[model samples]
Target: MNRKTLVLPAVVGLLAPVLAACGGSDDGGDAIVVGTTDQFVASKDAPAPLDPAIGYEAGVWNVLRQTVQTLTHIPRGGGAPAPEAAKSCAFTDTENESYRCTLRDGLTFADGTPVTPEDVKYSIQRVLDIKDESGPIGLLANIDTMETKGDKEIVFHLKTPDATFPYKLATPPAGIVQKDKYPAKSAREGFQVDGSGPYTMKPEVEGDQVTKVVFTRNPKYKGDLKVRNEKVELDLFPDAAAMGKALDDKKIDMMTRTMSPEQAQSMLAKPKDGVKLTEMPSLAISYLAFNTDDPAVKDKAVRQAIAQVIDRGAVAKSVYGSTAEPLYSLIPSGITSHTTSFYDRYGEPSATEAAKILDKAGVSTPVKFTLHYTTDHYGPATKAEFETLAKQLNASGLFQVDVKGTPWAEYRPAQMKGDYAVYGMGWFPDFPDADNYTAPFLDENNFLNSPYRSSVAENTLIPQSRREADRSAASPAFDKLQDIVAEDVPVLPVWQGKQYVASLDGLTGVEWSVNSSADLQLWELGRGRDLPEDGVQGEFEEVVLGLDVPVEGHRG
Candidate 1:
């Protein structure tokens, strides 16, 4: 499959809860088959070196969420961070610089080895040591060093005050791994490492490409939630169409990737007899990045003008079929501290105002610029998306647009090197927080490769916002941060999406493990002849997940 076939239409993996009806085989009592796009996996074949330190891909994180226990986890109920491996945790001081966690007693890895605070400290420190650029090491920006006080207690010393530290730990970046199985300085390449999560992968079934990897409930897992299915066979498909067809054929029970608007709409319209669709709001954002080094968009006025001229609502409706909504801020909706700063500053799409802004900057109309996007990385609608955007800008007579496409392998490196004058970028939150939106883009030498500068967001708002333990006070700081992003216009928020899944009728508890981020709790999935018309939410309880396999089962 091509890169486009690999990536889902929207951010496919994150956190979620809801209930629905779907039918499947109940022969094994509790066994379900899951179908997803192959590209979601960090490494196509197996979870080897499933080390969280180097595992940043959405698919990898999705699997890791079930296979490895973290210090904390955002509940499916969508409130504060709840304890996972940690029995109890809190900030030790008012400055929010020191965090203390007490490990739950009797915690053990898949091999039945005790999981201690020392292992927790090692898991975090090792990630920082490896420091893979493609990894989630960036999420641990606040930690200074970790201290293990006895076998049960651990404390994290932060270099700077960060109220969001606990949430960071809840992400896969802090997924605890077995110290003995993984080396301290290097990554455990392949599926050799030990994980203490809800389920264990059957090593014998692991393979490359479309091969199936079966996940069986970890008998050693100490989590409270009972596994709805004894086994979940994850089968990757080349594209959405293939995955959808398989779902209809009953070859697979569920899907994780986001479908194209056309596919989703068709699925809804046709209404398969035994299929039910469920939708959940997501924290994902798709936007355009202006390469500040490119002379065409180097000027803030030109960037701002493009932001003014581009019609997000039109693109959302025409291309995405309202599956995605216009997003005016980097911090997406459904989260506190989100603000529509771009809409406030530029109002609706306007050629007149765009022309005035360019004119005021002494730049002539009919501005020439190139827009680059990944042909297959974002989704099939990417081409239509940029084309619609080009039409909106071109029709205004304020700019002439030349749109281009590239594969993800070439596009990611190129965009980061400022090779593209302007490009499209999709963001999936590392954790559900406003800081994930700002810090990655606005910080000095951050994610965007362009030489775009925003001192207020970098020096003032971001730092101040991270320090504020109280979200209410932090909201105003984030509000200012969005306004600054609007003024600088380094990137433009095009749209925010809601997550959806299509499953056969008679399936129940599809929503039990969904946190605010759209991650599915596979353990919560099961089949039922009759389910509630008004879906019920799943209960919340923290449990330590065990590794996917026993020590002898690992194939390194």
Candidate 2:
């Protein structure tokens, strides 16, 4: 939901006058600077070694999206994945069992090496081979093996039918790389980023960790995207207030990571001097993930008891202040397969029922459990949100709660390794589909380092849902899956929040740059003077070519 929520018509209306004013030079000259808090990228687990197979966060993706070329590109306004690095791609038959794509002619890396079909196969296989726990290796769970046909074609044999596979390829995790440039056995730790996308990173400046990071447009890019700026700089600050102050002083032209609910609401609803707000619908969900490996939270009764006691309504209202809506299921509301399973199971907060359930299970009163959260990444509201959670659980008197927080830099890896007893989890969708919401969290080895494994979810429900090409046909399976999650309670769904980006008045393309799922398209953005009079408002040109014949490849 990182897209502007005020509808395209409303955005167009606002941009009409803004576009005219953009012709003037009052905004900033030449380079465009975007300000963000240091937590934008995890400080310790920074997106460095930014090889697609390793990094998995907005900070890394914000740069990778502009530099890495994928097989296909999902447009700003969401729809079917369009051919990008691929000339054309499709399933071999009606089964949705196998996927194939023909590489675009003359595709070359920034280093001028040919981006052959072999590189595509290598790029994907390497990720699966490395199997980085912190990476997005699980996103490719459906892919059984990959085969390459000559230099231009590649086919993916899926373990099961998955209609959403193409959407996954469009993400950074599937970015193709030359095998020679990157190591075949392990990640090339210090390899230079030589990609075929619209931009390349500028040489790192000293103290860039606390100062800034920069990217320059890649002259070798073959895609149709218009890269207007000579440079794009991400000015990093210690906190949001400093970032905001820089934006107000015109030291930075834009600010993006995320702000506290109070800061976002105040800055966006009532813009400062030359700044404007571009708000979008977000598919991001915030929740509590239990490390079922821990003895304290391993019991389902304890999880269910805690779930029944906490009030999502009070958390949403008091902590988020209308910035977020209470979530009842893993599949967020806007997606097709979403269900109110959690809400239906636990209607309204009931401490009495929780106490009774715990007592019957031989669990004593005031069950001691620790709750972990990140200090940043989700925004300043996270502190308040977790505080509210601890307060509610402690108030129930059936549980004794302890809340602790670490910076996101440390929290993510530790949580993934099941280092926390019970922790907070937030998800920003990789794609707009419900599969993205449910599959990753419920997989055999999921984002949550929980010991609650559901064979029904892994074997039957998820597979059944992935097979159907028609999304609505898959809803029943997804519904059943949600019901199981509600009963199991490995991770308790909490809230769904909106996306907000603020920028100077003259910056064109902010509205058009955000995708349906709220991923920002940095390539689509440009400085005011360079942008077209209509901004990036017009329709995207359709991809016309289609191939009926299918080719096979050598499976490793």
Candidate 3:
């Protein structure tokens, strides 16, 4: 099937916090209830593992991040800096080489141990040196080293100047870990997670069908958003269509990130009696990447020729059916520093132009190559996109395109390693700055490595862009880098994907943020219907908390 099909949820037990009550009024009816169709994929009672290294991307870790603090955090919507685990983060130097953060005190884990700078230092260091197959070590590339200077302060020393350092630290990939709970030198020992967040992992269900994660308000969690409700329980669903059906039947209260384009369209076509739909411009773009090393795709001419043959308009219509929009550059349009380089360099998908380019390269026979795709992730339309691309390329008389498929979980590591001759990938903006878009992929040592022609981005753009503490000040450098990326066709620009959030009418504060990674902190959330306060509080009881996932919001 085309579903992501991650393993299943495991056991369910209560990881009771040392202090569960926030005074007699803590249990009052004021909890904000939210629901999503994504699953935890943890196993049975084996104690749902809490390693931030494993599969902890944007899919679910958003909640866990709110419970346990991070050095920095992108607030729910792409707004200003807000505190969750940190009190404040600021640059100590003008070059943006040195960073410092003051941690909130009186923070304690479920076991009642004080959360101090030592834990933060150890948590990040473990991800850096532990070298487990899991966790987010790749993101720690810019850091030379980090140390705890004071009980309430942690300082990060960079090997090179990088303004995005603070942004990286804010991502859920850097969620705080309990130094005493898991080994700091290797992969997390087991599922029993212990950290200081808003919630704790509860007993998991077998087959991962029904996982019970629990979230309680932290009395000391004086962050930007205060959850109206005290608890949130998440229910896992295997099928997206089935999940949509549940929302219709009210078997579930809400569905977060599990609606297919067709399903979303159908739901939008006919809104339920008490349901609402929130459509917003997501900060992600999906595209086809090329493996320049492969013989079939090795030539620069071949890659450019292929880019010219695929019709972006038709692909967007056929695959998304109006759910997504066409994209032209790595830097999304309308955003500052955006470019039309792809359009300028390759032009529209033209059969005549593509064939001419191929003929000029002296290719008599039809160029043949296999296009790899993923069966899961990014909904069900991906297959159609590939099919259309293949047909267009074949019709050009310049290509004999074949298509291959793999699951998303496998597709990610494979494509990043440049395993596919041509494959698809997506990116969610980690931050709003244009610098965030250009720096990640074209960097010399990026996971995709350097596909573009040699540029100063490696030696200059990276450090210089980072040195500018203000992203707006670094715009010119980012423009230069985008120019480089556009000229280099390691990846062809496709379409900027859109997001549709379907929820019950009672759900308030339904908004979109570029940083969808932090969408699950339900402090300002509330119901619409005129229900008793206890009724809302009862809703909170049903919603479990504590999902240990990574921040994969930028999967573009």
Q: Tens digits of per-residue lDDT for model 3 on 292-379?
A: 7888877777877877877888887776766667777777753556768777777767878877877788766587788887675555
TM-scores of the candidates are 0.86, 0.87, 0.82
- By TM-score, the better pick of 1 and 2 is 2
In the range 96-136, model 1's lDDT, one tens digit per residue, is 88888887767788789989998998889988888764456
Q: Candidate 2, TM-score vs. the true structure?
A: 0.87
Best by TM-score: 2
- The residue ranges of model 1 lying beyond 4 angstroms of the native Cα positions read 1-30, 38-50, 191-193, 202-210, 224-226, 529-556
Q: Candidate 2, residues 1-556: lDDT per residue as tens digits?
A: 1101100001100111111012212224456666555333323344344667776665555556778889877654555677778877888866787888888777788778888888888888888987776677777766898899988899999987788788889877799877776777677553245578877765343432435656677666665466666667666676667866665565766666555567766754676665566555666677788887788888889999988988888898887665677889988876777789988998888999998879888987788988887775555667788889999999888888888989766776687677898887667667667777777778776655457789999888888887777777788998998998889898898887766555555577766665434454665557665644222222233443222211011000
Name every residue pair that clashes in candidate 2: 1-281, 1-282, 1-283, 2-518, 3-280, 4-279, 4-280
Ranking by TM-score: 2, 1, 3
lDDT of each: 0.69, 0.67, 0.57
